[model samples]
Target chain A: MTQTKIDGRAKTREIKRKANLNLLERLYLPEIFKGLSITFRQIFKPKFTFEYPDVKWQPPASFRGRPVLVVDDETGVERCVACGLCARVCPALAIEVVADETELDKERYPKKFEINMLRCIYCGLCEEVCPEEAIVMSKEYELVFTSREEAIFGKDKLLTPASKLKDRLEFLRKMR
Target chain B: MESILIAILKAIIFILLFLTFSAVLTYVERRISAFIQDRLGPNRVGPFGLFQPIADVVKIIFKEEIIPANADRTLHTLAPIISLFVAYSVFAVLPIGEKLVIDGKEIKLVLADVNVGFLYILALSSLGVYGVTLSGWSSNNKYSLLGALRASAQMISYELSLGLSLVGVVLVSGSIQIDEIIRSQANVWNIFYQPVGFIIFLVSVFAETNRLPFDLPEAEPELVAGYHTEYSGMKFGAFYLAEYTNIITASLLVTAFFLGGWYFPFVDIYSGLNPNLSAILQVIVFFGKASLIIFLFMLVRWTLPRFRYDQLMRLGWQVLLPLALLNVLVTGLVKILL
Candidate 1:
């Protein structure tokens, strides 16, 4: 700490005063005119603007949007075994899952799973806590709902086929 | 009887043209500002939102006229009227063309041929301060009063420089009439000789008209819509319209004073055209010159940041006033020497 303070003091000593403006420059009027000239040129420069609504922005696969339940392709069933892990992990209390008995391979399946889009913080915590990789973040970000009822995304809204979520699954696999 | 008809025609033409121009400017200002910020502005109203101003007018007309319970209703109503009146009235003295000949009677392009037109313009613009001050005072809000004070202060400070700057033009041209000033510039434009005067006059008009870089009166962040805070509906629209109309008038004045109104260089070659055609061409040239200056006004608004209230005051009193006085002195000395 003592050596660092000495070095800092020596460095401060090397600092030089900035050059002052000449009398003409000090007048400020000419420099303002120069600044105006620059901005005038900017008006003709190529603008980077989108015709939004007509042309949508396509976010990358790595983009974390609304969390969705992954539907297994071969089995034709939601991979969420109604483990209730997502509900427990949701910081916003946005997720609600009710487990029911299933005859096929898994003993438990979610009879009712709901995620309140309004309450959802888009933290991806629910997606991360999924034990079976059942839920993952999907890039379908542009959400519009006038009513609260419409905003509460149920299984109909939440479920995405594993084929559609290949990129996110692969990314997760790579990370793991 | 024919001259009366001609005067009426001029009035109708002037009113219709300015209103349309002011309306078009609303759309243009939005589009230009949007481009500056790299965003696509209102393109949904009509094709490229060309009809946006019409929609805006409709909306403003339909909006409820709200008067604050504790506010001065009479003064509040009167303020916008006064502002609109002053704005429309100033165009009376401005000459846009040479003359129009129809049925053997030639009509002067200007609505009124007042001898002291320039002085009238200066006087009327000074009175415009009342409208802003009344609007602020009547609003019964602290912010409104503050905005009113700032606006009145700004107008008063700049009015001196605005009047002083034009004195050099008056001295050189040897006439206070707007028409005579333009007529005198036929040989050589006043801008060549009075460049400093033109600069001072130009900057002063920006402040006088309450344009950006000098728009502390309605500084969005500080004062919520300035003196017109409590105004609603058409009253608010009137003040907004008045501001834009003032811009056109200022541009016209600039064209008249320095740019040689309706007098383009080497125009004698084209003087052989049909007399009516020549007059029409001169009118076109005048408007063309005015439009260029108006474009500069809008460009400067987007380019420069607003001056601080103190800096604005300092500029009016310190820089522009001294420069304008010097220009007048030089012009006076040159007149005597020559």
Candidate 2:
């Protein structure tokens, strides 16, 4: 950015005074009529109304909705090693994880995981910070929670089968 | 007794029709404004949102009425009623059709048929300022007071041009009665002779009605709800109703003065039909002309930004008032020459 020698108020005032008009502009009616004519023409223009309830908008996988935990199709278990990276990176302090030992190749699994939907800004930082690509933004934008307890999403709500998360996974891979 | 019966019947029928038309206008305005902005307006209320106004009436009626503790109770209660009364009262003298024949008796379509109908309308419209001003003063709020002042000042400033513009029509027609004015234009509309005056009158009517581009009193950015800031529930509804009613009254006045009220072009060709049928057709024609003017009002509202306070003042005093006087002078000269 180029630094100015002085404050720009004087320059703006100069530009304002410089934009002079002739006799016709002084009349004002012609310009008013021109504006009216343009708006009159717009009466026949096509309207862009999305009847939202009847017609649901299916955004592409790259479109971030809400973050979800990815489950491995082969092993029928979560791909997450319960790493605290997401919890640490979440700006809103929305994510919580309790790690426990597991028998699987991934030695650690989250015994409990909760995200306070109220606190979550949906910034996708937690998803970005995940090392294993276990948490990714999903296509579940419509979220309505009546109570505080209902808003705190747990593992049962977060863990989606890998098959359902195919589009988002492919999208992330393409981006990388 | 017979005349009184006719009067009561006419009043009942016209009031219902007028209120219904105002409600429908709200729906039309929303739909048209939405189309202009490339968005769908309210369509979910009912079939094409036709029943939306009914729903609105219900909502407004049920809303709790709130009065500011410091507000003048008597003036606050009386203000909106005065506005509504004035708005509806102006329609009393406007001639909508020729004489109606029933049971071998003739009945004039207008309610009062005041000898100086045009002057009466102008007088009543000026009185409309009191309603707004009172609402503002009684509310005891700063914004409301400013709005009230703006409204009164703007109305007074534009009323001069408004009156001057109509003088062209009055001079050309050589009559003050609205019926006689329309009758005078059986051959040609006054708009042809007084084009400049017609334009001035149209602009002044926008200002008079507190419509957009001249809606300084209720400028949302500057004043929150303006004079009606403290008004709630049915009282607020009355103000809203008064506003829409004023719009219709202004359109009707424009029709009566410049557009030749019920006098359609080539009306002699259709003269062979039944007189009753012809009268109905004439009323329909008058309504058609008025609707076009009303649509223009809506189109303008969506098109133009609100004028700055000083700009509004300048346009009213400097531009329109002088132009109206010039038009009157030219019209007078032409009348004498012809």
TM-score of 2: 0.94
Q: Candidate 1, clashing residue pairs?
A: none
- TM per candidate: 0.93, 0.94
In model 1, what is the error at residue B233, expressed in angstroms? 1.2
Chain A TM-score from candidate 1: 0.82
Deviating ranges (above 4 Å) for candidate 2: A1-13, A16-24, B266-269
Q: Go through the candidates in order and give each one's C-alpha lDDT.
A: 0.88, 0.89
What is the DockQ (computed on Cα atoms) for candidate 2?
Answer: 0.71
Worst 10 residues of 2 chain A by lDDT: A9-18
Which 10-residue span in candidate 1 chain B carries the lowest summed lDDT?
Answer: B266-275
For candidate 1, lDDT tens digit of each residue in B1-338?
86677779889999998999899988888887777666667788989999999999999999998999999989999999999999999998888877777777777888898999999999999889899999999999998999899999999988888898899999999999888898899989999979988989899899988888898889889898888888889999999999999999999899999999888765653466766787888888888888888878877888789999889988988888888788889889999899
What value does the lDDT take at residue A103 in candidate 2? 85
lDDT of 2 by residue, B1-338 (tens): 99899998988777886798889888888888888888888898979988989998999999999888899999999999999999889999888888788989898888888999989999999999999999999999999999999999999999999999999999999999999999898889989988899999999999999999889889988999788888989999999999998998899889988887887776564367777888898888888889999999987898789998898898989999989999989888988898
Give me the displacement of residue B277 in model 2, in angstroms: 1.6
Q: TM-score for model 1?
A: 0.93
